[model samples]
Target: MKKDKPKYKLIIDAAVVVIAENGYHHAQVSKIAKQAGVADGTIYLYFKNKEDILISLFEEKMGQFVQKIRNKMSGTDDAVDQLKVLVESHFQMLADDHHLAIVTQLELRQSNKDIRMRINKVLKEYLVLIDDVLQRGVDSGSLSEDLDIRLARQMVFGTIDEVATSWVISDQKYSITELSPGVHRLLVKGLCK
Candidate 1:
């Protein structure tokens, strides 16, 4: 049976909040069902299990995130500008969705090793976008051709992840958007020729 798009979104949104509030081990289908305002059995109709819910939540949110950045980058021709937009968009998305930020940065990490591995797979799409920008910069002579794409991508992603996690731990007092320019500058300096 086909599910309504809004209903599916609501379920995912509710799951994020439930998971964020309760660690993964404590997050039960019943809790998510209550958060979504659906019966416990209704969750089963949509998801096979709690792990399924978590995986789907990551997939849905990350998919939309990647698509939004892809659309935004379509208007910019410069690789450097695209990289800036990608960094800004990523930080801004996490900042704008505090619930999602908690889920992604905190609760999601509480999952077992296996689940974390699957979540990493979903995150690769975003990392690939970063790599694409770096490759473009190298091709355009804006960045050093000798830069190792894999290591550069890791540094960029790892730095941003650390920054975001620190903000989340600190209660997010300052605006994450403010860090975008500095991050862009540092990345460009490290990678540019």
Candidate 2:
């Protein structure tokens, strides 16, 4: 029987949950297959190996994330607001999906160097979007021209990442969505003139 796109997406979703619940080392193909409701052999038909599934998952989900933010920010011309949307959208994406939060914030980091590199490749698109916003700010004289775009991008990413990781570690007790404005303010204050 031929599998459809939705079926593949379902498998990836199941894999994310399995990986999040069980660390990467402990999450076996068989376990993911069971969680995905497909036979172990069937998983092979869709993915070459476990690593492929992970890379594919990041690509698919992160692609959607970038697309959504791009769509939402279309009418907003202010670089600061663009930056705000970027940060908020990122946190909101993870917040909306607890399973994805666990997988992205915890389990995915447990992968080896190569897998991590691949994940970074998938994340570059988002980083580029941040960089574009910073560049626009500099161009408009809204942000300090002396600021290092690369380091600034890293700072934004690092801050949001640390915040999300903290939330995950704390069992998500606080409202991540509520923190967006403050985070955006701090970032803007530091980066702007």
Worst 10 residues of 1 by lDDT: 1-10
Model 1: number of backbone collisions: 0
lDDT for position 86 in model 2? 89
Q: Predict model 1's lDDT versus the native.
A: 0.88
Error of 2 at 3 (Å): 10
Off by over 4 Å in 1: 1-4
Tell me the whole-model lDDT of each prediction, alpha carbons only.
Answer: 0.88, 0.89
